[model samples]
Target: MILTLIAYALLAGLALIVYLSWSFSPRLTVGVAGLLSLFLAHGAWKIFRKPTKGRGYRALAAATTAGFTLTAATAVFVLFYGAGCGCM
Candidate 1:
């Protein structure tokens, strides 16, 4: 319960930060977001692979999976459009 709330709050914070930096280079945006996501992904992986009867574990796992999927799709978008947007 508390964990889910915190994760969501952090997720929203991340989204806001990314939105605020919209003018940043796309590759930089992707890199920073990807770097940040590494921790989230790791946590999610642990939660999914080893369930310790934690509260809201299922919700957290779902959120993490969705986050990863969206991130991956964004990467694909960047790969396709990044060069046009001045990414080196």
Candidate 2:
């Protein structure tokens, strides 16, 4: 559970760094963030499933996975549709 939280925090920190250091374009920002989120979500699932003495870790992992999955989906939507809008 703690590890899941720390991983998410690290992901957020990395995203912030990318957003600040890289281009402000949605294609780059959202693409990187989305990919990272997907990877983290998978990692979280693995951590949850790994045999461990503590059963309490599942709750955090489940919640984190769901949140990351949602974020990834939204990022995909933005990359495909939101960023391509002709409004600009």
Candidate 1 local lDDT, 1-23, one digit each (tens): 55445545555576788777777
Regions of model 2 farther than 4 Å from truth: 1-57, 86-88
Which pairs of residues collide in candidate 2? Answer: none
Q: What lDDT would candidate 2 get against the real structure?
A: 0.63
lDDT, candidate 2, 12-84, per-residue tens: 6866887785766767877877877776777567546756785666665676777766766755644454443
Clashes of each: 0, 0
Task: Mark the 10 consecutive residues where model 1 has the least summed lDDT.
Answer: 79-88
TM-score of each: 0.40, 0.36
Worst 10 residues of 2 by lDDT: 79-88
- In the order shown, the candidates' Cα RMSDs to the true structure are 12.4, 12.0
Model 2: residue 61 alpha-carbon error in angstroms: 0.5
Q: Which regions of candidate 1 are displaced past 4 Å? A: 1-35, 43-57, 85-87
Q: How does each model score on lDDT? A: 0.63, 0.63
Please give the TM-score that candidate 1 achieves against the real structure.
0.40
